[model samples]
Target: MSAHPENRAGLWVALASFVLWGLMPLYWHLLKVVPSLQIVAHRVIWSTLLVVAWLLWKQGRGWLRAALAQPRAAWMLALSGALIGFNWSLYIWAVNAGHVVESSLGYFINPLLNVVLGVAFLHERLRRAQWIAVALATAGVIWLTVQFGQPPWIAICLALSFALYGLLRKLVAIDAVGGLGVESVYLFLPALAVMVWGEAQGAGGFLPLGGAPGWGLGVDLLLVFGGALTALPLIGFAFAVRRVPLSVVGLLQYIAPTLQFLTGVFVFHEAFDRDRLIGFVFIWIGLAIFAIDGALRARRTGVTPVAAASEA
Candidate 1:
């Protein structure tokens, strides 16, 4: 049977968000000549301005006041913001430093990490398939570590930081946009400080300064629009998670990592030796098990996997 129109729309929106996320390496790669920290500062500064404007238009000043009125929520969001900021910087650095494959591996492991976090902190019970999936993913990490002769710190950090951020957000009861606005507020000062420091040190290139390689009108535009680029997919994702089954959303999340892996291997031509490929194969096996199990449970219970697929 055909699906409901709204469901179709939600699915499309979710797909778009993942696709954008998948292709983000290309965007960051353009600024490879620029400092990753500078890119991050621009991202935070402009994103704060844009998202706050959106909150003002949609929610007005009262919402901001309301969010700030709660001390615990404020602190939690501050922590989450720091985590995301670090994650963004690391991912940008990875993409530019020829670690896109490692960064993508982090994302590929994120959902499983989320599952582990849920079980540990939220006291949630996991099924047999979930246990196996987690086991397989753990094996992948071990294999990768053995093959690389060092732990994949980049991947581990990204997965853990983002997983924690998602966990905190799940605990908060606020609109996604408003929460992000508040988090950005917490992040804004530090980002601005970094920008100022960079400028003082003659390292800032947000604008053209005597024809620096990565400094020009084009770079300025990309840096300014980085905020929108960061916010749009998130906005789409928030809309999508609410409208679609979490299982479907969970399935779609792979699109981003898959695209990143392809870009790393095919487009950028990053090294992917057999050992590394074997490691990723294990992770893929785990993800397959996780997805299939969630789908079956969703079918049997006749309920959306919204709660189950919080692996996002």
Candidate 2:
């Protein structure tokens, strides 16, 4: 049977969003000269501006007030904001530091981590296949750890931070944009303070004021555009979720990390020896099992899986 027009459009939108997310390493790499913290601060400041402007336009001036009306949601969003800010900072730093391959692994592990979080916090039960998938992924981590003689801390931290952030967001009673808007507001002051301090120390990246040797206009533009880059994919994902099935979205989530992996190995020429490949292969098999199981269950039950909000 032919697909509906909206679904087709949604598929394209979803694909675009994930593609943008996947290619983000290249974008951040362009600003490798800038301090990772400065880049993250700019991301917060500009993302705040864009998100707040969009919210005001769509929901009117009372949007912030409405979002903050619930005290529970207010505090929850504050925590989630902190978590995401940390996630963004680490991710940008990792990309610039040439840990893109490891960073990709973190995202690859995130969905499985989500399943574990669901079981622990939400009292959700995993199917048998899910149990096996998680176990296989765990073994992969252990193998990687043994091979490297140390843990993949970058990947592990990213997965943990984002998983926790997703958990908090799931419990909050706000729309994705609204939640992000509030989170950005919560982060705005601290981010602005960082920017101000950096400039005062003559370490800023945007302008050469105070005799700071700023990178250049190109870098400045990329930093500013990072806000839109961060937000547009989220907006697209939100739109796509309403038009597409969750199972499809779940499967599509792999695109970003796969592209990131390829970018790291092929584009950046990062090291991916046989040991690393073996570890990744184990994780990939586990993910395949997880995806196939979910699809079969959805087909049998005739119930679409619940759509997850995009963390990218």
Candidate 3:
């Protein structure tokens, strides 16, 4: 298929999105003083502010008022909000708790899981090569489980939670900004309550506190900075989705995980056992074949490239 301009744009945006996500562990590393929970709260609050600000900037006050008009939309986004919160909190915990490598593995496996979810819930069938990709990814996961003598619980949990979150989001009739705004709003109250509790316990986060604050405060600021960073790439991704084909976008997602994998092993000093080595080999091969297949299909069918259309 010929690439659409929007598709090309979205591909770049999505590419940027993964790159940022992959690099996030480093930012988390700076939060040595703030409790991980506090960091998450900051992410919620700051991200909420950033997105709402964008909505106001883009559509004026009416967007917020209009969003409130649809109770169903509100509810759907609320559910999605919870799922994302779980996903985000768990992810932050994983990275900070010395499971950065495992977290990367989760994302590497995510797109494949997304494919499976599409089949199970959306009734979309995979091509034969795509099935092989699934098989290879499954084997890689199984390898990790056996290596650990347990399920790859941390990684699997993150992937499944996010997959389910995306599924729920798909069921809703909301735009990216609108949906995220609702979800964050829903999350904010509870988050604020937690901060209040933390305050009572002398654990108030993201505020000016009295003690010689630890390095975690720096991390809190980073979290806020990340919230600002997060919005731009999503906006870019929304643009890209409309212009690119699914196959192209799908192929590009690997860039994020690939970087995470490298960061885990090289930067975080994560161990790569023999089993993981073999598993990675399988994943790499599977991806190569998957790409070839997707490319061939695009060539033969001449499907139009999808544009980045604004879903986060």
RMSD in order of candidates: 2.2, 2.1, 2.9
Q: How many collisions per candidate?
A: 0, 0, 24
What's the true lDDT of residue 66 in model 1?
93
Where model 2 places Cα greater than 4 Å from the true spot, the runs are 304-312
Misplaced by over 4 Å in model 3 are 1-11, 68-71, 205-207, 210-217, 305-312
Put down candidate 1 lDDT per residue, 243-296, tens digits, no spaces: 788667768889999999999999999999999989999999999999999878
- Candidate 3 lDDT tens digits, 123-224: 999999999988998887787777778988888998998898888777775676677777877988887777666656667545454343433556556767
Model 2: how far is 276 from its true place, Å?
Answer: 0.7
Span of ten consecutive residues with least summed lDDT in model 1 = 303-312
Query: How many clashing pairs does model 3 include?
Result: 24
Instruction: Rank the candidate models, highest TM-score first.
Output: 2, 1, 3
- Name the lDDT value of residue 270 in candidate 1: 98
Candidate that beats the other on lDDT, 2 or 3, i.e. the better one: 2
Question: What is residue 117's positional error in candidate 3, in angstroms?
Answer: 1.3
Worst 10 residues of 3 by lDDT: 303-312
Please provide TM-scores, in order, for all candidate models, with all chains considered together.
0.94, 0.96, 0.88
What are the lDDT figures for the candidates, one per model? 0.88, 0.89, 0.75
Clashes of 2: 0
What residue pairs are clashing in model 2? none
Q: CA shift at 233, candidate 1, in angstroms?
A: 0.4
Task: Return whichever of 2 and 3 wins on TM-score.
Answer: 2
